[model samples]
Target: MTTLRPERYSATAIALHWAIALLLLFQIGLGWALEDLPKGAAQFAGYQFHKSVGITILLLSLVRLAVRLFRPRPEPVKDGRAQMLLASAVHGLLYAVMIGGPITGWIIVSTAKVRLQTMLFGKIPWPDLPVGQGFHEPAEVLHGALGTIGIILIGLHVAGALYHHFKREDVIGRMLPGAMKSHGVIGIAALVAIALGIGALICGRLLSFAPANLVTPPIPLPSASSEGDIAAPMESTAPEEPTAVVSESAVSSATATPWKLEKGGRLAFTAEYNGEAIKGSFSRWDATIVFDPEDLPGSSISVTIDLASVESGDSQRDDMLRSDSFFAVGTHPTAQFVSSSIRAAGEGRYVAKGTLLLHGQRKPLTVRFSLNIDGSRATASGNATLQRLAFGVGEAEWSATDQLRDAVGVDFNLKAVKKAR
Candidate 1:
């Protein structure tokens, strides 16, 4: 009058168990693949996939735990107390890692100094844990340690399963999809070997890789003189006091005598991060200048810079600069500088009082430059110091001046030819 207890796992339990297992193996490979990839878009993508799979395993593990609590399971095989306890210990540790691994990973990302937003599979937004920077180091150490522990536990689990299947012929079928009676030891062993081989190959390649192209050329620092042209280098001299704020409407774009911007110019910036200098530059930009050294009142200059073109030698750092935490190029793709007035600072030096619009914020900027005019060409070289935080260039933890300094020095060298009037 009563139903009998099944000799194997329920269909639901079997499905969750195998699903989590396969994902875990794939996740391990992905983690290794990240190390093989260059520190650019490829590595970033691999990390995202790893995160997605980790989250998936975490969810599935929870479901499996719930099923274990509610659903009936198979009876233990008639192994001795010591062997049984050992088997139980391995299963318990496996579950711990299946759940703890993802939790620790999540913690690492959440408390990261950069504070980047986590997007699961690039679609669903995952929120960070409301933990402080203090937790970041501990979580990172634990996450890596757990990964090593998980690998060991997985090997033990597989060996134990194979032992039961081949020697005692008792408990192996309980979690198998079909509850089949037997599997060829050779076939199982070959599959295990292939997986291990692939894993080893990935690790080897990652360890041996030396990225030759990863080294981006250092930003060219302005020099005192170049060729026969009189090129002035960046001077520590400060510009004169600011004049009236330049209104957007008052900044005239149409200069009577416009100087065409020639190629071979550089616009670069330098900032300190963690006591190390980070130098980078914008590859694309346009400028409009109307100036007759004699007519200072009518002179005006405007520059449009592509924010997405920032290159800092490091691809990962470049990506971070483009993200919302820095330039937010998606929202503000370009930055602008409009001059309100220009005045002579020295015999060959000039200061252009203007406003710089960056990261959707506007702030006053003074550009101190040296101009040397030839028959039909002019070469100008100078530098400006900008407070990045004033324009919201760095958000979250980056807003702190200690790590990435607030004062970013901008250096520029421009060459132009007078228009044929």
Candidate 2:
């Protein structure tokens, strides 16, 4: 009697099998890492990488399935019909999950409502599906459930191969390369990989369940100022040192003179949360302006905002806003704006080109306003658009633009008294 050799899988099939297996292992670990990261640029980058790998897995799985369908496979070892049927079911489920997991994740991204671009591995661009919001939660649930099912099916598949190989059968040899002889070694490695993957998933879930506010102390806001009261002027009149310079326009019809902020002035901002607009104001801020409607070239203005003096009506929200996630009051307690140039927009209307420094980031800003001077009393009303993210005003989970619009509308109704010559 002559001993028979087992038929091995085609070279292409074997290559794809191992390639996808390694990628799947990497993806499982990446997903676990993504969930445990804090909600910031790092976490965002992690998501992008995870999405890229998931999509790669999806494409590879499709290719493998196509090859499996058109190409011939090695014959099954001599085994009972019941065992063969069980093996077929397990393999079928594995294939289904390999394809379905990425699709479900894609669906979640498609319906997320957040305007996040999918940059595959930070290089290739990937488009979201046509699905809209409302499917995100459901798709997330299904994807997670399928992940659990995939783990189980993988265990069964590995166990079946080991059972046959240990029983002196040719089951594992069918998929192994011709040079490989020991199926037991490969089976044990696969088992270890699966164990490590499960452990990572468990640890990730525990971290996700931990409270976000536990590590950091609550941020404190400055005490509110007395209502309807104006801050008394300092007895000294020496000019305070300026942070930045403003270019003086050529003297024109407008006069250039100093003006001081008086009682009844307000600087407020509006931000949107969950699609609802919320308004807030700073009770303590100072403005220094040297302006003349005719002398546009010799005009300048600078404003300093006390971040801790912010009042948004709701104390809880205000505290959160001052936390490390938003203003980080302890690190940056003030926001400043200095005009670089002032140009007349229209009749009594003007635009101030300037730089705004907030949360340690400085960016160019423009304020459009109308000015009316009535002798010593002057009134100026203006509005400007501020991008919160540009200045790192919101970090972590608050970084999501969908939850809070990046653009905040800042409006000021300033009352000023001109300094006597």
Q: Compared with the true structure, what per-residue lDDT tens digits does model 2 show for residues 1-421? A: 7435337777888878877766766666567666667543334445666788889989999999998887877777668999999999998988888888899999987776444556676467678799867778988998878766876787798789778867877666666677666666656655665676566555533433122212222122111011111111211223333334433333233457777677778889889989999999876677767777777656767777767567787755765666557876545667876666667777777766556778887677656678787877777776666678877878778888999998788877878877763
**What total of clashing residue pairs does each candidate reach?**
0, 13
Error of 2 at 25 (Å): 2.9
The 10-residue segment with the lowest total lDDT in model 1: 221-230
Model 2 local distance difference test score: 0.67
TM-score of 1: 0.54
Give lDDT tens digits, candidate 1, residues 127-164.
77887888878888877777667778778877777777
RMSD of each: 10.7, 14.8
Model 1 clash pairs are none
**Best model per lDDT:** 1
Q: Which stretches of candidate 2 lie over 4 Å from their true place?
A: 1-6, 132-134, 182-421
What are the lDDT figures for the candidates, one per model? Answer: 0.68, 0.67
Q: Assess every candidate by TM-score.
A: 0.54, 0.49
